[model samples]
Target: MISFHFEPSSLSSTEKRDRLLKLSVVSSPILGAYFFSTGDLSSPFACPLREFTGIPCPGCGLTRSLMAIAQGHLSQSLSYHILGVFLFLFLVLALLYFSAELITGHPLKISLSGPLQRHKRLLFPLLGLFLLSYHLARLALLWQSDQLLPAILNSPLGQYF
Candidate 1:
């Protein structure tokens, strides 16, 4: 089974520092989103998949969702992305856990990966199917609103379609 046990005395100084560094790298974006205002932000680029095919990828609107979350607008965030709240909570929890470990000089000892390995076969396909269906539903809504054709036509690669 894979599990984390915190024990300050279980890790060397180098191990603690290395773990903290990795956690810091992963948590940087969460900090940025919390401190920055989305109103002041503008995108210089579009999603490559969307720019080319005019269909949003699975992660589309995630930035906006994070921004909304940062602004304390949970409903707005949900409107931007259905999965945003879960992602936000996961990041915040991970950041807090790692920060606590760093401050207390504790390291998580993750032992054996059998449990996760056993679940992957069932988990991956379910996740993929959910995403595919969600994307199809989004496309149907856009089509119903008469926005689908325009989106395709305005895309850089749409002329070939």
Candidate 2:
């Protein structure tokens, strides 16, 4: 059986951030699949960062993109977020991996983390730069279209202010 445990004091800031990032990326595809299977186009979860900061998080458009992909609208998905198709493909691979594990009675030890850990010094910075650039571009587009203020005002937490 699975168990829940917490030890906030044991984790460093970097560890906490890494855990949060992993949770977001890993959970998105699974949750998207669940919503798709259930015919729920709307996600119940909102990005806490976006809600509070009135800014789109790196993963902001993911759910809508996933929804569009589920409906076989590739162009619509790309418009929402360029990474959605990649995430969807990752989800498919994960499902296959899980199924293979079940059939073979042996969990595949696919160590994606090994390479990540090895090159993390270089990889992490590049990833951060890319995310930052993409976020800035997204913000610029919103600003150009005169949607920035509206986005801020319409944000869940912003609505109260």
Candidate 3:
């Protein structure tokens, strides 16, 4: 069995980011295998939040969204998870960044950090709120259309409905 320890305080931010990018490179194929084997927007991987609360958290359809994006179904992917296209792009960017870093002998200057540093505290929470709102809106649409019934019916309060 494999075990892992993540002690970020021990490493410089650049080193930590580089390590994560490297890990992303290694995990792409594994993610691809999962996406292919799962075979649709409904992943076999269950969300604990959804199971317990009868409502999805912000990331419910991410895997399916990424898979759809991989299959060139951009619109469908966005319908599954609004931010998944951006997520896929970030994954691609990380893969390229790590690959380039490996081929070159120097560390690259990180992008996004400069801008993020200015409003790090404010930006992250706002982004989280935006994503949660988007997810709730999507769920509302699904619920109105009766598409989320099966999931709802399986939760603890399913007895009342």
Candidate 4:
């Protein structure tokens, strides 16, 4: 069996948290650019799971969705992939939180940790179901819409997709 394990470092909690927060801030712009870049949008990168087994991956339209959101088309972005919208919002919030922590030397603390940890058994399956359903709906919408193809193709990033 192959297994992975993570051992907490000896670094002070504050130091570790600060380092993580700083990393998040530094990577935000790069992530945003990658999300919005036209160059990567047109790449012919095939989904590994899809290629190996001829099944569409759950993340197929994510890139297009990100591109659409980056271009300021919220409705079209959601139609492309709901995950993209969620990701965009999450990233934005995370960036803001990290920035605030960095500037103020205080971290945002979530109060639901105890309940969340206790409910992991249920939460994991629910998360999986949500993701699967969301992706399938996105794929269906993509198939039904012809407008999305040309719109994506016409964009500067379309050439790279």
Candidate 5:
């Protein structure tokens, strides 16, 4: 059996890569659940933020998109969430890359923190701006179309609002 526990500081670059890959795999079931299920779990799985505030967060449709992608419905995934395809592909690639490193015993860890640290100021703000813009646009469109609030209000948790 492959041991999933490893001390990070004691890990070789290859081991660390393997650890990262395993961590990604751990989330696969959840992503699969989202991909396979039609989200009838809303009663139990609803986002508390959305349930109470009637606001859709940036990650709202992520799982459903993954489900669509799992079924080979790329366009539908994108329709559910614009960046879902990218996120899903990224997770899959990361898992595959790390798993390969673990099996090959190669230290192919890509050190990105250095450059990201160097450009933190610019990158952080840009990321924030992009997220804020996307969220606002999503909210604006939903709000203007008079859909978000009503839908939230009609859900089982509507009494809370």
Candidate 6:
């Protein structure tokens, strides 16, 4: 049996800010290369899971999606993987928040410090539903369209997907 714990107290604003900055630094070059690389830009690196299983992972199209966005193809990016857009939005917000924290010396904090803390009751269920729906949609698309997967994987714009 496995047990899981959720403790809001463990969420540290400083750590969040630092992590955001680190991720931005790490993603920059990959994003740049993804944008600049010519066609035939499949990764030299192989996915270990795919190698062992011969099945694509749920995350298979995400890199190509990012590459598409880096290359300024928003429609193709979203088509490759919807979550890539969410990730880009989250990254941009995190970068902005981190930048503000660095400049102001006060990291942004989700102040569940008052009655808002109780709002977790509503927030959790809503978030869960959203994630469930999103994944279901992706799975449906994957099942319905074999071409979709390979199209994303092989697209010249797919270097980022």
Tell me the tens digit of each residue's lDDT in model 1 across 1-161. Answer: 66677775755788778768878876866676666645743332368898898878887777677777888889988887777787888788777777767777766565657777667678869878987887888788889999988888988878886
Which is superior by TM-score, 2 or 5? 5
- What are the C-alpha RMSDs, in order, of all predicted structures? 3.7, 10.2, 8.2, 9.8, 7.1, 9.9
Supply candidate 4's per-residue lDDT for 97.
57
TM-scores of all candidate predictions against the true structure:
0.76, 0.61, 0.67, 0.57, 0.67, 0.55
Model 5 deviation from the true structure expressed as Cα RMSD, one decimal place: 7.1
What's the best-to-worst order under TM-score?
A: 1, 3, 5, 2, 4, 6
Question: What is candidate 2's CA lDDT for residue 89?
Answer: 87
Error of 4 at 56 (Å): 1.9
**Candidate 3 Cα errors over 4 Å, as ranges:** 1-21, 29-41, 111-122, 146-153, 157-161
If both were scored by TM-score, which would come out higher, candidate 1 or candidate 5? 1
| lDDT, model 6 | 0.61
| Candidate 6 TM-score to native | 0.55
Q: What is candidate 6's lDDT per residue for 3-115, written digit by digit as tens?
A: 22333344367766676667578567456647654564354355554554434556666667667777777898787777777777766666665565555554446445455
* TM-score top scorer: 1
1 or 3, which is superior by lDDT? Answer: 1
Give the range of the ten consecutive residues with the poorest summed lDDT in model 4.
1-10
Candidate 1 colliding pairs, count: 0
What are the Cα lDDT values of the candidates? 0.76, 0.70, 0.70, 0.62, 0.68, 0.61
After superposition, the stretches of candidate 6 with alpha carbons farther than 4 Å from their true spots are: 1-45, 110-161
Candidate 3, 1-161: lDDT as tens digits: 22223332344567657766786765684378345745555665788888876778889888788778767788998887888887877777677665555455345555344556666679778988999789889889879988688777878777466
- Evaluation by TM-score, superior candidate among 3 and 6: 3
Q: Name every residue pair that clashes in candidate 1.
A: none
Sort all candidates by lDDT, best to worst. 1, 3, 2, 5, 4, 6
